[model samples]
Target: MGLQPIGRRVAAACAVVISGTAMTLLLPGAAAADHTDPPCGPAADACINLSENLSWLMSDGDVTFGPVPVSHGKPGYETPPGVFQMSFKNRDHHSSIYDAPMPYSVFFNGDIAFHEGSVDQQSHGCVRLPHDAARTYFYDLEPGDVVEVVP
Candidate 1:
């Protein structure tokens, strides 16, 4: 009777160890699955895949950061899909036309910019990323850097 409890504990410990090892073995594959090669290739500074709702920063044809979740304009206000260049940057930008706050903005096409916004919600003809991603992208891109938005 005394050994029965010890045996159960030993079995549980072994199960835990096996489960942990399995997770460790699977982690690399899972991370690899999360990343995909940017369609615009490594030369492009940034790529936004609207179909995937994904964005990334590229350098020398390699992804330096991202696969971050982004939100684009809703049905009525569709974000224009095309290749553009980063035209301007503003760390504390506000939209006078819409009277809305647009923080960490990186403007690519006219009034359309990549800025901090709710990832779960659509924007008004803008690419919206989470706060951290918006800031990272804003800093990563320079004026004249290529930004491709693809369907």
Candidate 2:
């Protein structure tokens, strides 16, 4: 057969095996693939570690950060995952529920936003934090920053 596209896995080499020692190196294969576009690193000053903080309740419709007030959903009905770009910013727009005005809205993954939301792990599946948490998250981020929503 001619050279056809075949799935290839670079076998784990003994020299590259991760051992009991602290060692940092560029990974092989898909290791370089950005989990989200624009590549979010804690050092980038634009990364938000969403997966580490909350759970995704696709059926419930919100997210909860302890001690932070609850927030409701945005206008759109779908929460997207994977790499997405921040579309816009809304500081005064009202949420669909709770009737409480949030101070910040960090829109990412298309219409999905990581804004001041309920601290209950609800919503279509967006990572929701409290007002202060959201402010801190958004404040540290600029437009066009990449966000990762992992399960």
lDDT of 1 at 75: 95
- The segments of candidate 1 whose C-alpha lies over 4 angstroms from its true place after superposition are 1-33
lDDT of 2 by residue, 28-104 (tens): 21223322222233223223334334322111121111222333333474344455556666876565755555457
The model with the greatest lDDT is: 1
How does model 1 score by TM-score? 0.76
TM-scores for every predicted model: 0.76, 0.46
Task: Tell how far residue 129 is off in model 2, in angstroms.
Answer: 0.5
TM-score of predicted structure 2: 0.46
Q: Write the per-residue lDDT of candidate 1 for residues 1-151, one digit (tens) a residue.
A: 0112132112111111255446432221112358676677555788888988888777777676667789998999888888898899998999998899999999999999999999899998899988766766766788999888888
The global Cα lDDT (0 to 1) of model 1 is: 0.75
**Candidate 2 wrongly placed segments (more than 4 Å):** 1-78, 96-102
